[model samples]
Target: MGAGIVGLATAWQLQRDGFDVTVIDAHRPGQGASFGNGAQLSYAYVQPLADPSIWAQLPKLLLSRESPFSLRLRLDPAQWAWGLRFLAACRAEVSARSTGTLLALAEESREVLQQLLADTQAHCDFTTSGKLVMYGSEASFAAARHQLDLQRALGGAEQHALSLADCLRVEPALAGSAARYVGGIHTPGECAADCARLCDALHGALQARGVRFVLGAPLGALRREGDRLVAVQAGNDWIEADGFVAALGTGVTAFARRLGVSLPVYPLKGYSLTLDAPVGSGLAPNVSVTDAQRKLVFARLGQRLRVAGLAELAGHDTRIETRRVEQLRRAAREVFPLACAGTETRPWAGLRPATPTGVPIVGRVGGAPANVLFNAGHGALGFTLAAGSARRLSRQLQGVAERPRTAAALIRSAARPAENSA
Candidate 1:
């Protein structure tokens, strides 16, 4: 029950499949994370968060107050349990397997996005100019080669390792910043879109297709009959449906728990700042960019430039930390100082529903009240992989044909109890 990109995309795909779909959300459409993302359709980056070295890095990261990553140490036992699971998933073998699975889903989702954009004729400032991951440190650039190899191994033909000069050549706007970059990976076929605009277009399209939207309605609970979810109770009303699909991002975990299912999704809060593109600065990038070391992403969205990154494991709070915003501003200035227009900046925060293994949960929950499906837990790749994930979930919900077991397994992990008790 979300109106974010994942939920809306799932609903759109189902509607196209002739399913009577209704999207319910506690907030208005496109007013959540989907409204305020970095807007990069990053296909070259399919890496999982659970790196083998992440555990070692975490202690240091947590200790460093200015670090891009931070974890709030509350008294809640659930946070501790989630943290332990996150650490456990950081093993080399687990990370490798998760990376492989994510790459497959991301590639599939990319194709679906292409088809959807074409068929819907949706205009949302979409461009396939490509994406670049720039590195300041030689070591960071060297480490990225392994990731590039993985992408190539997974049929990412357009992915290439570019020299610093070559990166600037590909995106002339980065000419001045060439000295700061040692090298970068360029994914030529990757895309970028104004996410908010895309969501608006999709919302209109869904409305035209007779899909209903129940906005500003907080879901209370699932009205269940034995093993079946009969309807969703929201506030003072019950909306009954033949089937149910849950794509509620971070909120999915609680809802699923109430339904006696466990979803390993947790909130990873990220921040973004939007600024007007500097007039006559010639600093607007044609391709989206990721500063690997700083964990910041820069994307040019229409007349505005978006700088977003920094993951904080603070649960469900949208409070904007001034320090975090300053970090984003400083990073953007370092990359393209002239691009800063000195205009009033709009700051935003969103909770990315991150799973320890980095793969999203996208499948039907059997032995349910009805045809219950899930298409959530897509953390940072939500915008990049929404189309593909939604298409696959829609197919399963409609019972058209079964996907391969490997694909199904990647989408639907067996439910496990919270390792750290709340």
Candidate 2:
């Protein structure tokens, strides 16, 4: 059980669809990955990391402890099995299909997020400033250009390559290091939000809507009858629901197995750091930025800067490795040196529930306890796609025919030119 963004969003959507919803979590709402992410509501990103070229580079990444990607070899045998499946999905064709699926979900997610904010009259430092991805090397930039073409072919939104000067003009904070980047792509329609604050507001709204939140309660086990879920046991008490949603991130696998359901979800650990910006720093980045080489991402929330990266397969160990933190700081300094000065830094680690094909298992878990639905395995795109996936889940549970534009279809559409823009 989790009270993270996806969980809360799922509860909210269910309530809207006339369901009596109760949410339970092992921690306070939004205290997990949703609280400490880069806070990028990125709709432009549709590509999954299991690209075709990754198989060749896995050994190098695994051997280098300080590399952006890591795998804790001793954790869980299931993690290794998941990693192998992830590698299998790295074929070019597979990656394309996965990208298409995610893009569809992400696009719908953006719309759902906007509607939720508007309906609740909630604000969480939200902005439409969009996202910018810069390339440091010419080769990398060239590759990005090629990928953008594929993105366009896959129904991606309107995007333009920016020259060094234009990129600096769009984001004055990057002027000093303009030379380091050969070029950049700007998704002017994408948006960003203070993820922690958004979750807080959503939790409040859900409470007002009569949704119950059981916090800091660990799930003991599931009480099941023949082909049906009776209730969930937590500690000494049992809580029953008319329906159950498994949005428990990495915790889904074991729970699913107990219920005789097959879930391909596994944990992909990622690290992040938040730094307080100096007064009058003039170093604000309105748009979120992702660096390909270092796998680093930068997003601004008022005066605080969030820098997150490094996907380590460390098997549920939420320990913060100093080396990884240092790498994140180094990347931030390289890109925005002035922003890191005189700032107190806090490091964080979150397990992204990732699936091999990158698409979340959103449909009902057939042959399981009745009314059990899954909305997990989102990986890094949880924040980016939570609202949309929640909306999709709600429609499905209500037996309402989803609009023709489903999440999977939208991703394919977004990869193409027509639906690419916000």
Candidate 3:
């Protein structure tokens, strides 16, 4: 039980499906990882973090001062277990398979998001301004082009390898740093928005739909009746429901473990900075931009610019590392110096509940109660894939007969709550 974007999204979907639902979270809605993110609906590029190229960059990732990815080499058992699985999933075949599955879910998510926005009539500064993945090296560009070819093979459209001239034509704001990048892969169907605003709107909509919210309510003991959830112990109060869904981000790991389930979800910390975009300034990005080498994403959110990146595998610490924050600041200044908005920028850091395969664990926990489900571990694409993941789970819980056959097959193993339990 949570009130993050994933939790709120799932509750909304369930409410729409005519289910009585209640959301419980220790913090206010969207105050966790959903609060600050890259702010891009990156649906087309579903590349997992465990790419084959990561093995090649292990040295730089471990030693470089300015490397966007880092591992602190923890002595924690969960970290080691997750790290081993992460290494194993770094093969080419695994990466390709994960990408395919993630893209399918992401595509569905984009559609579901659009439908939800239309149905709820909520405002979140949502915009479909397209996306540009700018590359700094020829090797990286070639690799990305190869990815484009794979997407094409998988029936993906509206994605193309853009020339330098074409990149400038699409997002003229990058002209100032034209010499910094080689080329870009453009996806005109991608979207961007403020995730916090979406969460706030979703919360309001759910309330209007008669859904109950118990904010600042930390989950304690979970009571079960013969492998079926009976009630949730929340700060001395027992809240009973027919079913329960855990969307508590990294907290899901411990909660699941209490029920004898092993979740591979680990926290990967990321940073973001939001600053006002100068009016009439040609320096602000019109389309969302991703710097290939730095692994940072820049999106224009209404009058503000959101720049986010860096993945730190350093446990669940949410402290904002000034060094990392400075790194983002310098990158913003270097790329769009004139649009900085000085020191008035809002800096934030959050732990993304990441998985080795990058495919989220949006299913039921084995050995847990029959009615308990999980919708956590979305890694970096939580907001991007939340709606579709929630919709699928809602249908599964509702025992819908018209569910997509293909999706059913894909999630059969995951849909079973007792898959590995006795």
Q: Evaluated with TM-score, which candidate comes out highest? A: 3
Clashes of 3: 0
Compare the candidates by lDDT and give the number of the best one: 3
Cα error of candidate 2 at position 100, Å: 1.1
Residues 1-422, model 1: lDDT tens digits: 68888888888888888889888989877777787788898766877777775766667788886677998888866677677777877776676666666666777778888878886788787888788999888877887887778667756647888999888888777876778889999888887888878888888888998998888789986777766778997767789987788889889878877776666678889999988887664577767888887788888777778889999998888899989988888888888877876574779999998877777777754433345677778888889878877887776766653432232243334222111000
List model 3 lDDT by residue over 179-257, tens digit each.
9998999999899989989889999999988998888779988888887888998776789998889899989988887
> What lDDT does each candidate get?
0.77, 0.77, 0.83
Candidate 2 lDDT over residue span 1-422, tens digit each: 56889988888788888999888888888887787887888787767887876866678787876578886687567777777777777777777767776777787887888788887777787878777889888877776787788888867777888887888878888866677888888888877777888888988999998998887788987877776687997657688977788889889888788777666677888888888866663475667777776778888777777899788887878888888888887878888877878566678988888877777766465545656777788888899888887887787777753322233342232133222211
Candidate 2, overall lDDT? Answer: 0.77
Off by over 4 Å in 1: 366-370, 400-422
State every prediction's TM-score relative to the real structure.
0.92, 0.91, 0.94
Model 3 has an lDDT value of 0.83
- List clashing residue pairs in candidate 1: 81-420, 109-388, 228-369, 229-369
- Cα displacement (angstroms), candidate 3, residue 365, comes to 3.2
